[model samples]
Target: MADSSSNSLFIKPIYIAFVIAFAFLISSPIGSYAFTAQNVIDSPLLTKKIGTNRTIKVDINGNGEFKSIQAAVDSVPEGNSQWMIIHVRKGIYREKVHIPSSKPYIFLRGNGKGRTSIVWSQSSSDNVESATFKVEAQHFIAFGISFKNEAPTGVAYTSQNQSVAAFVAADKAAFYHCGFYSTHNTLFDYKGRHYYDSCYIQGSIDFIFGRGKSVFHNCEMFVIDDKRLTIRGSITAQNRKSANENSGFVFIKGKVYGVGSTYLGRAKGAHSRVVFAKTYLSITVVPAGWTNWSYVGSTENLYHAEYDCRGPGSESKSRAPWAKQLTKEEVAPLMDVSFIDGTDWLPAWL
Candidate 1:
């Protein structure tokens, strides 16, 4: 009705602006991040039918009490001792979560492992900060969750000191039916009395390391292969300071398999001790198991042992001289849950 040429110019500019905006929406990093953090389909593990009654909810999609996990954690009162149950909804939460040492008795329950995933791109060079989920508090329990580190597990991975999926530096912490995914230093058990049950841990080099006194039961310690790795990968790098340190790592009734020719462990600390008792090892394990970090003949101080383990890798005749094949009597002390003194705080264990 107005001048036809004027109307054509107005419509043309508006159409062009809309097209440019749509293209930018698809190409921007914020768009990608939002897509990655979007809510997931309800996982079977996250069903409300499950017995998760006494807990607060964290839904990243704004349908729950909190949108972020860190906010839910911060809501807890300081120095509170009662069990704080935090039920996380299903989503790919792109966050670096940290449970500080001051907080304790925190129970983090995820809907399901395949549903709720916390992912971070931090490298091990960040040390404790490298963990996608850092648990510094004691008396903690996590069920049906996944912590993943998205990094290239190169054969020559010197770029980072040690990237960890979950860095746990607390006493009396327990993980059940959880999944840890990474390449190197996947589970940093940093000086704690902890228990892992029915968890899946995968890594390549020194995957499970630290100075913690932890026991792994019914767990899968998987060693993935790196084609670039000419030198074989190792599973553990325990750092127990001395015999009197009351620090050791024991894996009982567990599965050690995957794509690797790995040593059982390395002596990172002077009196590092590890025991694989009544477990299954695949042929991927090296025969001369257990190596030293630096000093030769350091196996004297290293207490690496295996007892009645099955599979092709468990045959111990060719094992390292420093690593012993323990008898039942010797394995008795390490086999019990009391090895980590879990009776005090391990829920459903006592």
Candidate 2:
């Protein structure tokens, strides 16, 4: 009896070991939480490749690197960067900054978008480039930060040029819970594929402009006007010049509110394409949903359309003759996951 008991004890341990191994193998692929925990345990010493030790803490009162945003960006190493984190404290940074192409993997985290603002005032016709904050870095992410261009109200009327607050010209970039504030051309997607989720974008004319493939999901778009002018004066000016270019703009589950006029949109590019799926529009949107850039030509080749939009402004009967209301069957192909999906190139915080 003693020999049998000892044998049972040995077999029990083996069985337990087998069970543990099986659990790990099965959970690793199916459970994200378990997989992440295992990865951290297995590679505790691993670190980010770029900006591994580069951390810039910017507080209005705290003693750290330069106080201005431009100064801090200039201080980071020039080329071949892995990752860098810039922690901005609660303050309004009034400066125009640029993230050059040389530096990649820049993660800017602010205290909060409501508290931390990077603001500048530059009209597109003021000899300043249309884009206030131009980012040329790949895999760039901005969280809890606000980009604002405080151009004068009448400045846009005098100058028909588009003024962009934040212009993104990078690939695999993402903006989470950020605020883009401007009178016109708030956010410009100049190039590459990008994503903006849970963000607040405000503007008057073509607030969200650009020629890139992007996805804006669960975002709030506010058209602030003292008097009703137009809803979406200019939404997209996609520049899909090359046949190989796969570029378009997607707005999913977004809310549009008008502060004044009721004109919804205008297309600026020859082959510009924009989609509004599962969106809510306010009464400020005109009955004719879309307008042509000059009202003399058809935007048929531009691929402008809407699907499953709700609210008072979503009526299809009064929509522009040139505007194509897409059916679920016609729009299903454009809803592919890979349309806006790229390499997991976004930062961890985003």
Candidate 3:
């Protein structure tokens, strides 16, 4: 009886060691069950402070060394800072801002939505090849501000082909309670992953165009034109590059209104895809919801789907043959937190 008890005790220690070793293996990066708990715990804290706290408020109207937004951004130390907040006062600042990768995790907060505006007029087809506000900084956030591309509307077929107001080339960026105003290609999601919530974006002719993986929640997309105009233009032109890139544009719980006649969206690239889920579409959306952008061969690869969408434009029978009506089960994985949940390193509601 004593021999049996000793043997059991010896085996219990070995079993415990084995369990611990297995757990360590499972938690490693190569393990299939690798967890991000440590990452979440180790993420840099984001708050409103400078140097130590990471928030640097910039009141353009206040008495400070920096007057323009660009000057304030240039003043901040690069890479060493994590989260920097620029509190812009109520004023119309006509300037082009560029945020480089070296200045990541910068949050631009304005006094009020309509009160602070960044106004500029530039077109992609024009002599200029860059956007009015170009962002290459990851973990960037912009709220309570307006990015206006002041190009005249309805001047279609001109050399000023693609005029973009704000171009985001940053990963894990978010825009809340902001407005993007432009005539064509308003919010350019160049090549990155982003989230936009409760924002107003207006444009015509593929205004919301990009090759980025992005999600827009509870946003308003206005298609502008006069009463006599027909074929206003598509709202989005998602030009995703690769199949493995998770490259697609998602519009959830959004309202689409058109002052003139136009289709909702079109797949501009071969592998481009878009999903309109739980949205309200106005009669401005064309009968055939998805357009090919004059590309006949790309119809098979592009995946344009809709789920639980309502309004005068949500007529599936008249939709394009290429478009799809996704099942509830199919969209379940897409709605998970991980897809849109970036490091969660930024402040909440930013």
Candidate 4:
């Protein structure tokens, strides 16, 4: 037999196996409590509000029914039509939550804005997997919640990253008193008729992007620099495949200001469209106000327009020829909440 001193130096085989398994569990995104349609069904509804639209409670301290938001979402039944309210307590949650398309009419209610935060880190290369929160349902509403992607520029990300904080592919979806923060593609308004009222979005380079038909009312849009990689970045990168897509971003009565020079947007899709009416643009916006990614067949047909904008960056003299200076008549339809069809779905509380 080996000497006792030599045997004492070796760690238990079980301990070595445990350490390897623990490392793999934390780093690998796959095979780690992977969510699927079946997992959602297997989970039981945590708490159901009695009378009016059903309500579920989520508290981080274990006071509520569920501890995590994703568990609360999984508790909901598939094809749920009634308004299921998710009451989230004030706490910082690190989770990648997805509200599948089958679960509709989810109302995320937080105790207060800026206090309840859901954060994650994902890069542009990860594609849709990078979103901290993604709602693929319909008729959804969020009140007083902040979604963020905490991908640091120097360590986790470089100049060209597409980290997304939130992705909403819901129709007639509305957000009130919320905050979205990230560096690249913060708010992916991908495919839907959505409304953002009294909300905040902070980012740089194609932050408020996608093909959704969206309207921002009394919201705040801030452009931030990614570790000084580029002097400027585009605020929006709308991807409208064709003219009849019925997709665009309308910022009505919002403030756009922040560090470093940034353009209003660059065309990721050929028929990309964005309009700013009765909004504030700070000097951080480059005088040019627009940039074409310069790809063949792209940006050539982009529709970037502004009307009644008031700020040092709103001067139309130096703007690109392709961008338009619309008249009051041209922006009437967009000024109303009807642009996102909110008249039919917006709650009376709004």
The candidate scoring highest on TM-score is 1
Instruction: Name the regions of candidate 1 deviating beyond 4 angstroms.
Output: 1-54, 154-157
Query: lDDT tens string, model 1, 1-350?
Result: 58999999999999999999888876897777467534322323332323344577999999999989999999988885767788898999999888898888788889777888999876755558788999888878888899999876643546564678999998889887789999878999987899987789998888898999999887898989855667667888888887799998999977899975898898888888899988899998898987885644456788999999999999888988889999999999889688988776666431
Best by lDDT: 1
lDDT of each: 0.82, 0.72, 0.75, 0.81
Candidate 3 lDDT by residue in tens digits, 1-350: 37998899999999999999888888775564245323321112223322344445555676555568898788778883556777677788888988888888677877556898888877656422536788898878887889988866534556666667898889888887789998777888877778887789997778888788888877899988632254457888888755776778888877999677666678788888888888999998888998886665747888888988999988899999889898999776555334566535435432
Model 1 residue 42 lDDT?
Answer: 30
Candidate 2, number of clashes: 11
TM-score of 1: 0.82
Per-residue CA lDDT of candidate 4, range 94-114, in tens? 999999999988888886567
Choose 2 or 4, whichever is better by lDDT. 4
Clashing pairs in 3: 49-55, 58-87
Q: lDDT by residue for model 2 over 147-173, one digit each (tens)?
A: 888766533345635567898988878
TM-scores for all predictions: 0.82, 0.78, 0.80, 0.81
Model 3 regions more than 4 Å off: 1-55, 60-62, 126-130, 154-158, 226-231, 343-346
lDDT of 2: 0.72
